[model samples]
Target chain A: MKFDFNNNIPIYIQIVEQIKTDIVAGKFKPGERLPSVRDFANETKVNPNTMQKALVELEESGLVFTERTNGKFITHDTSLINFYKQKYAEELTLTYLKRMYDIGYSLGEISKQIEQLGGNK
Target chain B: MNTILELKNLNKSFGAKKVLENINLTIPRGKIVGLLGKNGTGKSTLIKLINDLLTPTSGEVLINGKSPSVESKKIIAYLPERTYLDKSMKVAQVIKYFAEFYDNFDSQKAYKLLEELGLDVNQKLAKMSKGMQEKVQLVLVMSRKADLYILDEPLGGVDPATREYILDTILSNFNEGASVIISTHLINDIERILDDVIFINDGKIILHSECDKLRTEQGGSVDEIFRRMFRC
Candidate 1:
């Protein structure tokens, strides 16, 4: 997974987001071995410890699972994937609504705008 | 929260320099304790004494109602300011050694962590950079589901991003009913996560209070109160 070091977010967070994106995008197929922490760290030029943290977060969130001696693999649970997708989608929508509301957009106006822009995606 | 560790009138001095004095503290189980102190204020010394790496010159320490001993060592997972590891050993070897010594050691967790860290069991510790070595040490320490985890300067001298990751590791890991005591002057980053704090100055515990109560009652951050109490 590619990392943007200069991003305003923390590197571990960036790593977490990237890995989740990969899982969501099917770049990491179910049961596929995730990259070794050292390889990921070396590739990103970040500390292995930092990389490990991202994986731990992923594991905690049920996006990945680890098998001793074998290695870490992407979780194959379709419901779990949908769970995260819906969770993040709702969060982003709420955040966008908040931002728009802060700029004086009413709830009705925002809802109307979403309906107009909904088909393109 | 059971009393996991207690210190009574603890005092320490090196030559003419007094590092800590009249330090009394009781660490309860299942809380994140933040030990705040500036450089040379004896934060590390306090941890060393608890781990029995250094004998306290004065006062008493009790782990599970007895003096710190081999049995107590079995229960505590200590991460020192300096990495105390055999650099010659491979990452897998150290985990095995820890597992052998500590019956509570979880091999599956260790292997899973190594996999997550992307560390090969065959990789030599000496070959890794200092930062990698630090990660290895942390992974080993955290892999254990110990009762009391003592971390000294867990984020010292690391890049900001790595520091964030280290903090996350501390937060995400550890077992239930296990208390984690992190000693560091980096108050701003860890203030939010700490359940309680003990501020040390000249080897004495000048302030001891719950972080939330202190904030709510005093209407200030731990760092602000720390600066006020420590102001020269």
Candidate 2:
């Protein structure tokens, strides 16, 4: 997982975003084990408590599972990954579309650009 | 559309030191508000005044556009910064007490939450861990389904897992047209869920805005802005 310490966003949220990206990119396959909180925090130079908060949010959202003695692992379900990816994609696309429209882009022109970018499929 | 609570030029002091000064806040219904401030600020005092636990030395506190009275107490559910549960009482007894007092209390929801938290109703408050007690307190406060939910330091002294549970309980239990105020110094953890925010310092409001608009106008995350504004 990657963390940009210089970014203004909170460290925990950055960790969450990176984990989600890894899940979508297949870096963490279904049912794969994740590094323990301490090890991950040590490697990333973040507080263990902050890392724990990110992992807790993931578990709460059903993207990860924690075993008391064993450790946290990626959920054995890609559907959750797909679900989040689609949700995020739709959110991001709407944001982009809004900004484009605010800049006076016509629907036809936007559609054409999207199509040219292989969005029509 | 009535003002659910208002503080008019309220001033409060503890011993020889002044805490809140000329504090005025008017809160409307159905808004989820974040109360942001550093430690020892008057955020908790504001909550206490609303709940009638402490009286303002000067000025006024109103509930539903009237002075805070006994009837106002009936509609407020207060979760304090520290544990308020009687250590000798069992969870079941606490639930029963709350049910007897609150007109809108939902015992079933409380039991369901307890079960989800892996807590048994028969567990004594003294026997449970600190995190478990916090959960119980949250369960009791949320089960009331009051007109106003005033949670002081709701996320204090709890694990993130339990904090999520507490937040979800707050989110799921409140009905439409109900308002909630969560006071905390930990802004980042709860920033995403806040509809509005009131930033307090030394018992005075320094900032108040709709959460999204504040983030957009400031052009940074709430935590970042807070860190800058309250730089140490």
Candidate 3:
């Protein structure tokens, strides 16, 4: 995974979002062990406290889970992961459609444009 | 985490000139703090006070709940703004000196880092380039297993590669209960690694906040905000 850190967003938020994107992309397979907080902090070159905070937030959201004696891991619940994937896609699509609509494109024209874009994908 | 260093109502002056004023700060262990300010803004003065290189005019600087002294200095690994090694001394000689003087100093680790930096152990300090000298100094300071590390302008005279190595070395060195206070003007390169930032101007603190919060609130990087705040 790659990160281009921008100062406008909180670093922890960016870290959490990137981990979420990683999960969504199947880069971190379900039930895979996450790196130790210190190791992750070193790899990302961010403060360990901020990295720890990001991991805690991820755990709270259920996308990541603590395994008691073991370290953190990606949630083993495939359904939960799938649910997030669908929700994320819908959110992206809605934002894209809204932008097109604001630009004076009709719903039908937006659909046609998306169909044309699909072949390139 | 326990507080490793604190300055309570600290004040310092050089004769009639005021270098630091009414300063109050606390630093907890396990943090990487940036003491950021422009040139001649008393960053060095504050660090000197903490290291007891200069006495405070009023108030106090504390390390582990006690005033600065030989005892406190034991736990604080200080990298001064200028080179402290004798130019005639070989790199191996300096390592031996540090190992003997500072009980916490790790000569083995120093050798390892020097080798990693491609520095010859027998190199005389006078023969080394400015950047190479800085790298050797950083390696010596970082090898100490101290509770608080005070580095003044560590990235100042180094090349970009040396800067990266210094940052990485700092990242990997600190113990579980240690804290590092770095004084620097290179905000952009260091901001991402800092847990908290202390913005000093004209011997006074204009801002002391968590790096992430400041970034979030200002809607810009620390460097961007610093430019906006201190722009001439």
Taken in order, the candidates have interface RMSDs of 10.7, 9.7, 1.5
TM-score against truth, every candidate: 0.64, 0.67, 0.91
List residue ranges in candidate 3 displaced over 4 A.
A1-3, A91-121
Which of the two candidates, 1 or 2, achieves a greater TM-score against the reference? 2
- Looking at model 3, the pairs that clash are none
How would you encode candidate 3's per-residue C-alpha lDDT over B61-146 as one tens digit per residue?
A: 88999999899989999999899799999999999999999999999999999998999999899999998999999999999999
Q: lDDT by residue for model 2 over B1-232, one digit each (tens)?
A: 4678788999988887888988888888877788999998888888888888898889999888877788888788888889867899999999999888788899999999899888989989999888889889998888886788999998888888677567656765665567889999878777755667898987788988875566657867777888889997
Docking class of 1: incorrect
Proportion of native contacts in model 1?
Answer: 0.00
**Worst window of 10 by summed lDDT in candidate 1 chain B:** B211-220
Off by over 4 Å in 2: A1-121
2 versus 3: better DockQ goes to? 3
The superposed Cα distance between candidate 2 and the true structure at residue A59, in angstroms, equals: 32
What ordering of candidates by lDDT runs from best to worst? 3, 2, 1
Model 3, C-alpha of A71: deviation from truth (Å): 1.9
Q: Tell me the spans in candidate 1 whose CA falls farther than 4 Å from its real position.
A: A1-121
- Going through the candidates in order, their DockQ values are 0.04, 0.07, 0.63
Q: Once all C-alphas are superposed, what RMSD does model 2 give against the true structure?
A: 14.1
For model 2, residues A1-121, the per-residue Cα lDDT tens digits are 3355433455566678888878887888989988987677655544454577789989988889998899999998888889988988899999999999999999999988888997545
Candidate 1: C-alpha lDDT: 0.80
